[model samples]
Target: MATGFYTHPDCLLHDTGDGHPERAARLQAIEDQLIGSRIDIALQRETAPLASETALLRAHSAAHVAAMRACVPATGQAEIDADTFVGPHSWNAALRAAGAALAATDAVIDGHLDNAFCCVRPPGHHALREQAMGFCLFNNVAVAALHALEARHLARVAVIDFDVHHGNGTEAILAGDPRVLMCGFFQHPFYPFSGVPPLAPNMLNVPLAARSDGAAMREAVTREWLPRLRAFAPQMIFISAGFDAHRDDDLGNLGLVEADFAWLTRCIREVAAHSAQGRIVSCLEGGYALSALGRSVVAHVRELADL
Candidate 1:
């Protein structure tokens, strides 16, 4: 089976206004790099559908869903928080961003694809059950994980996050669930300031100090994430693929590079092959520095496609 690349044009309509790091240009950069690297022709590309209220309800409160709808502006941007904004098109974009993950999950679970990548936005992993913050409107990976467990009837699933920032919302939603295993490494003492001491036994959050190098990340993955992931033996895997930790990105002080992202993808792929029958779904979470984000995504997608 081929690797599926999912995205939608509506994702570009989510206007964060000027000077915001989480802009539509982020997705453009990745697409430009993919085309430049000629990786575009190697994978299957699909348009993301809009997520239903039923699907959104699985990971978010009905009030949250209603609030997102109520928050959508008919003309200009509406502020959900200091960092998060919703434009006229943001409602559709947010739904599609989340829907891409759901569609990819279905594709992978149905054996139509070996694995998939959802390159949509506004990025998730920061949005909570009732609150939107950190430029996220909904927890995309959490929504997908719950979909896998409930709709697809998967017994076990693992969510892996490597963003420079802790996936606090993901942890909040999935922490105590025994059917799910969530592992991540983030820059601690940083934004959101959670995950130092994990919320639950099912969560394995490794907090790295600012300026920590790729070596430290690798050690944490090998010593912490890998062992727990192997023991859990998940039936499916989901990745909160974030590249903000890249040394060039200013969003965080970590020193990861393209090679580090590739290595992490390889590790996850190996684990997926061993236990999940090679089913993996990765959704874009965070990555600033345009050049680094594009290059890092190319590296990650290349690994996902094994190209």
Candidate 2:
């Protein structure tokens, strides 16, 4: 089981600020841990390209893309919302982040790799079609899923989001599309709060409480996610992988550890093997606490690599 690792130095250029939870150091921590654990050598390392305007437009409005480009400051950071910002190099970083997911989708589907993990920043699950929020710039996983459907011509696809926060942006963009099945468990009554009732039938979003533990998450996946995923039998699977749910992470109150992330990855991988020809593309989302984030990502990737 080959796993392609996609990233770029440009991703580290999206400086969110000194004390911001979503900073370049998050990617640095993951890379450091990958090297420390000797997982870096087993994966295929690739540079993420800049996403084309065509690809970005597939998931975002033209006005929103133009607005994001215009918001890039010449030197300092310009706030998109209270949480989202655009710095000098953020445009390129955002493009690369989205591009990584697109490329990974192509790689996995084309059989260059069995699966892939994109470790870029400016996470995209929160960005809406007409707006950017929740530290997200350009819905990377959403763009990739669209690319797989439109360009690659895949019949059906599944999106699995295990982020602590609801992927309201993804649901907003992908809802009601019969070709896609979106499933996930997120902390309810949390930031951007929008997953209780579900936007559409295709969206199987399970809302966990503030202090939910891994046992709760596991139960949700087993009872809610797995059955629908198997029934969908998608041609590919995309993961909006987030680690902020870790107990050590101050961002959210969920009590998941590295083992929990690995368990979740294994479950997703099993479903993919059974239905999607083992094609999986995972893109990073939210994870604040550095040490916990690094360990959790390594565990997730280890499962993806079957290591």
Candidate 3:
């Protein structure tokens, strides 16, 4: 089966603001690259669905859910936090982002594809259970992970978050759950700095020092993340694939490039290949520099789709 590519037009409408790194053009850049390259793969293209409140509740609180919905502007934009904002189309876009992850999870579980990549926006790794912060509104990957176990009845899942910044929101939601093994490496002492002093046992956060390169990342994946995943033997693998760690991206100091992203995807895929029938669902997290993000993500999806 062809790998799935999950996305929505509404994702582009969730505008942050001028000068914002996570802007509409980021998605456009990706699409442009795909068309420009004419990359051949029987891509199972799927539109994102609006995630239900019940599904949102599975990963978030009623008040928190209501608050985010209420924040959607009628004709302009509403600021949710220091770095987060919502435009008129923010509600639906955020819904699609979270929903795309859920749909990808379902598709992977149903054997429609070996894996799926969610091209989403208003990124979710920074949004907490009750607080929307750091350019995030809803925890997309976490919501999908919860949906996979709670709704789809999967026993165990592993979420490998390789974003430049720590997935504080994902860690907060999935920390204590023994059903999920969360492993990732992020820049230390950065935004929403909480992964250093992790809260739970299932959370394997490898905080790399500033300026660490892709080689260091590979080592962390081999020495730290591999053991936990091998011992757990997850029924499915989920990746919070963020390309902002690329050398050209201004988001963090980690100096990884497109080749590094392809290599990382290969390693993560091996884990899935060995354990989960190659079932993997990866959601876009961060990658700001337009040119760099474009190349890095294409490299990632190319490997994920095995094109």
TM-score per candidate, chains pooled = 0.99, 0.99, 0.98
The CA lDDT of each predicted structure is 0.95, 0.94, 0.88
Q: Per-residue lDDT for 223 in model 3?
A: 89
Worst 10 residues of 3 by lDDT: 34-43
Taking the tens digit of each residue's C-alpha lDDT, what string does model 3 give over 1-307?
8788889999999978788788999888887777676762457899999988888888899999999989998876788776888899999999999999998899889988789989999788888899899888899999999999999998999999998899999999998999999998899988777898888999999998889998998888888888789889999998998888888888788898899899989888888888888999999999988888888878988888887
Cα lDDT for residue 147, model 2? 99
Which digits, one per residue and each the tens of the lDDT, describe model 1 over residues 231-250?
99999999999999999999
Candidate 3: where are CA atoms >4 Å away?
Answer: none
TM match of model 2 to true structure: 0.99
Q: Please state the error at residue 239 of candidate 3 in Å.
A: 1.0
What candidate 1 gets wrong by more than 4 Å, as runs, is: none
Q: How do these models rank on lDDT, best leading?
A: 1, 2, 3
Instruction: Assess candidate 1 and give its TM-score to the true structure.
Output: 0.99
